[model samples]
Target chain A: MSTTDTKRIVIEPVTRVEGHGKVTILLDEQKQVTEARFHIVEFRGFERFVQGRPFWEVPVIIQRLCGICPVSHHLCAAKAMDIIVGADKLTPTAEKMRRLMHYGQTLQSHALHFFHLVSPDLLLGFDADPKIRNVIGVIEKFPDLAVQGVMMRKYGQEVIKATSGKKIHGTGAIPGGINKNLSIEERDALLADIDQQMEWARGALKVARDYTVENLDKIASFGSFDSNHLSIVRQDGCLDLYDGNLRAIDAEGNSIFDQVAPKDYLNVIAEEVRNWSYMKFPFIKEIGPENGWYRVGPLARINTCDFIDTPEAEAARKEFMAVTDGKPNNITMAYHWARMIETLHSAEKIQELLNDPDLQGEDLLVTGERRDEAVAIVEAPRGTLFHHYKVNDQDQIVMANLIVSTTSNNEPMNRAVRKVAQDHIAGAAEITEGLLNRVEVAIRAYDPCLSCATHALGQMPLIVELYDADGGLIDKKVKG
Target chain B: MSETITFTIDGVKVQGAGGQTILQAAQDAGVYIPRLCAKEELSPFGSCRVCTVLVDGRPQTACTYPIAEDMIVESDSEQVAAIRRDIIDMLFVEGNHYCMFCETSGDCELQALAYRFGITAPKFPYMFPKREIDMSHPEIFIDRDRCILCARCVRASRDLDEKAVFQFVGRGPDKRIAVNAESRLVDTNIDVTDEAISICPVGALIRKKGSYAVPYGQRKYDHEPIGSDIEKARKAE
Candidate 1:
């Protein structure tokens, strides 16, 4: 449909969000911005496909949900399967090694977003030349910073490869525990890069500090809105991304919920299904969908947490808190800043877990009688990830429901896109590439890991006819 | 004479011993012909039919079709390529080949062929057929859903392993790979270290603890295409 007839602006295949998605802006009859939506159009039926599969195989199977965060899915599935496997508790070796692997994932993914995806928009002005507004331009201009980014990512990937197996779709996490333990050789290799990793992390924190200081006005107002925040935190309210009780805070940083068990997620959170997009809108159960939408990931973790345990990350958190005047930091651009701080925390945590002697222990796995149901949660780089499974007595999976990290931010991401569209394109007669980029910039700030809640359907019903050797009609497949 | 015969495969002259199949001669001459059930050590059963090539304008399996003098073969032509692609597509739909979560993914011949042919979404409908898995053997588990019905496991067992612990049962869609034992994997005579365990071309027969040992980047087909070795054979010339 042409804009002349419908007043619709569609940005098909949104860029830089880990996977394929699109943003659609609707204008009223008077040419005023009415609404905007970001849709994840690629549908994955992992839930349906995993049914009938044995619970022991779930970890490796579910890892295919997203190539960017396969480890996240791997860990979450394994933890849930841990319960299914009837483990009293994960052994010290298993728990610590999994933590190391998760931290490696967080560090690598966050570095990829900052250095590869978001830095171009920040280093270059948002309204800068569209042609030069990419990582290539960022490298062309800031060579040292670009190299540092690459090195930092390399450091994280090295940890992943060492702990798990490979950079993508490693099989470190298993049902009762991991299939293998971190070898002393691999541990020493990571320790060798510790100093370089810290230096790069500090440099990244400085870049974040400089960007925010330089662009205060833009950071404060662009896509800024009040909403609730969600994350997992320790009992003392320290930022604990790997394993902790669930916690949430209101827009004013008041505790909305705390110490919620991972198994009890259903009691506090609910999902709103929409036809336009397959990604479910997750919200606070008590508040209802109209006002319950909350944000997750780095900003939420930093803003809602009482403190970060690591010395350098704790210091960075304090500085960030002062910048936001404490509690509920809603400036979407500051997500980049919070991300850098979390990266530092991940690096420091990786060092701590690596230094622990238990990581090198020979106990790689444990087992017991299998249970029929299990639930597991972890803080993926995107946000809080939940994996729940129900299996029969035979250990065959009967049902599976996964609330991926990105699905939690679905409502807020869409709202940010709308806010950006309304703010930039409302008064303009024609929408330009710069304006479209603004909407993308707002969504990219969340760093959504897409494709978990995406599906496609063919429009205009068509019949596909298959022919045999003699050109005879053999079969017909139809879709609409 | 060195007791060798020469034939043209895809317009290239290839040499092999007498009674050698076209696939064998072509392979020695560095021509790659895709085959599923034609293992080097086993008898060529001509199963799966993925290695079909035109023998002077008539379609025949390159694995069983012996190379003869003055014969013209069209293996890589558009018509033959489409037929090969369709065969793979049908295999995808007929069985539950979920490569996304499969352990044998990077090393799977079917999956590698799909990647070589760029089979993003299959042309056929996903049957999601009701298939049974026999996890009876403690050392080896058989997932029938991912099986392509190739009897590499059967031959590897009977001839190489000499156990005769596996066989094919039924016909057409009802056809399946079966183990010697009736009840469970633990009842089988096969151990985790059997040659049959490593010989299966698919994820149907997998060693319990042998998966995920090789990382993604270091896997067999991670860096190069499956048939690239044959190409390398050609390139080394």
Candidate 2:
């Protein structure tokens, strides 16, 4: 085929995920993958702008990282401050409420991704007429499923709202502990709703399982990459979202590192620069420190965890284990399974929290002297999120750095896109929109929030360039 | 350099600190001015417009007006009451305020002011904006429909909290408050503190996700002035 005969694939202004992004795939003469790029187009410099602010204010300030995972940032920042202040000195009730809210966030966020974002594609079929492929479409096509999804999200949100005071940016979880207390009546109401929501979530999980089995060919043919997984694990060796140690494990279930401090995340995980996109490549510091690539998010979490706590989630985990020879390494399909398992676990965890009698007390926050530096780590709905800050004696922040989960999986996302492009495209026929959508969908499976990942905007051209085997630029495209 | 400005409020002439707002002067003169968004901790947003008073010959929001010597201010003129009623009407229409089933029914500033002004029925049609209840965090709760768009919460985030977590998205009637960085409050980053929660005058902002801890009939506002509640909040802080 002539150089001009090469097919170009473009997915413009990708939807369902946070912020804006585009994916482009270029096919060569042999119809093989020439180059694939995941372009992050928006920038808001949160780290730089946060400098010189008070350290006590970091929890509230960093909550601006992502709307969906503000709790992750707030808790992470608060915990980091607590660590700097000495953790044992912090209030126990505040700690409990923080964990409760953290779990609440995980439940609501994962429910959103499973039902509203990804389910539309799986339930309705990705190419099942774009006109009817949305949340509204989900509602019209499967009203029962839609209502369940809404209720599940509402229930999760209600828990957050009840505990923190507001659902979105709850000021409940502060630096010391929580600032608000739950009443017995509020607890009873939350308890009343949990059983129904859990049943709904279980039904949704079954739907996902059936859909995955039905569309094995389509799902398998999408992007897949093998990489080490990293996530937070509890002392009991169970999957944990809040107040746990970091663990890095290989595909064979071998621990690369465990109980790693968040401050030393730089020693275990390192970021690399990529010229094609704003997202940075995160690599394992021990093995591939220079370019030792690793993956985070739903796939990484499911792959690394030894066992889930909830019975329903554990059963889902067993089902997952049976699929990939005891270790589910197929990253593309992990999105579906992670969401189902997490939803089940979130329901179970929320039920347990609502039953706790101490949640009714009013001693939510405890004020103390401000710390000069702090670091916090929590598993956001996407994956592990890290927030580190340095503050002055006046409690104002001097420097800050955030390692967003999406940015951590950048290298793996690139590899997965390339793999999918190679398997599907043959000899450069016009690259169809359906194939491109699949590639973008694979990235969205991680529920990547580009706004939180980049958090800084600069005048960088959105360019897609194709390189020949000899490193010569064959074709270059740009979108402003 | 201590200058005092005399202004006629209702039928009495009162002297106040120079350059103070009519609301502030009237407040000092023991005249009641109903306001939802105005707070001592924040700069005046003037969005609620509930404190509109007849100043000289024009109806003006007392919160925004600067005091002038010999200026005649009517604290409860018919025009002021009408404007306040209209503002309350707009708030009721924009939000999904089901007063009968609300937790803040008796304690709500909007409801109390409405009752005071004899607004038994909303003259405007209810907008019934499709709002979401965010119970994602353990302590804070947000009802987007109940939000009056006074932006006191937004100002609190910017001024007192300094988080800038709450932001007004879209413009005019389409305006809605967003937490942290997203359109949906459930996903956005916002700290659920008492200061942020109490900043909201309408039922839009409330504490936690569950039913009210203090039962409807037993709420503090039923027996005390709303100002006393502010005093309690200040002491607690």
Kindly report which residue stretches of model 1 are placed more than 4 angstroms away from their true locations once superposed. A1-6, A455-480, B1-101, B104-141, B148-167, B172-174, B178-202, B206-237
TM-score of chain B of each: 0.95, 0.87
Model 2 / residue A257 / CA error / Å: 1.5
A285-364: candidate 2 lDDT, tens digit per residue: 78875547767776677777788888888898788777777864664766777677787888888887777766766655
Candidate 2 per-residue lDDT, tens place, B32-125, comes to 7889889878887787888888888787889989898999988767777788789988889878776643556667888877777778989999
Ten-residue segment with the worst summed lDDT in candidate 1 chain A?
A455-464
* Model 1 DockQ vs. reference: 0.20
Off by over 4 Å in 2: A1-8, A289-291, A362-371, A456-480, B1-30, B33-72, B75-237
- For DockQ, the strongest prediction is 1
TM-score of model 1 vs. true structure: 0.76
Model 2 sits at a Cα RMSD from the real structure of 12.4
Q: Give a tens-digit lDDT track for model 1, residues A234-335.
A: 888889888788899998998889989888999999999999987899999989999999999999999889999999999999999987687678888889
Question: How much is A432 displaced in model 2, in angstroms?
Answer: 2.2
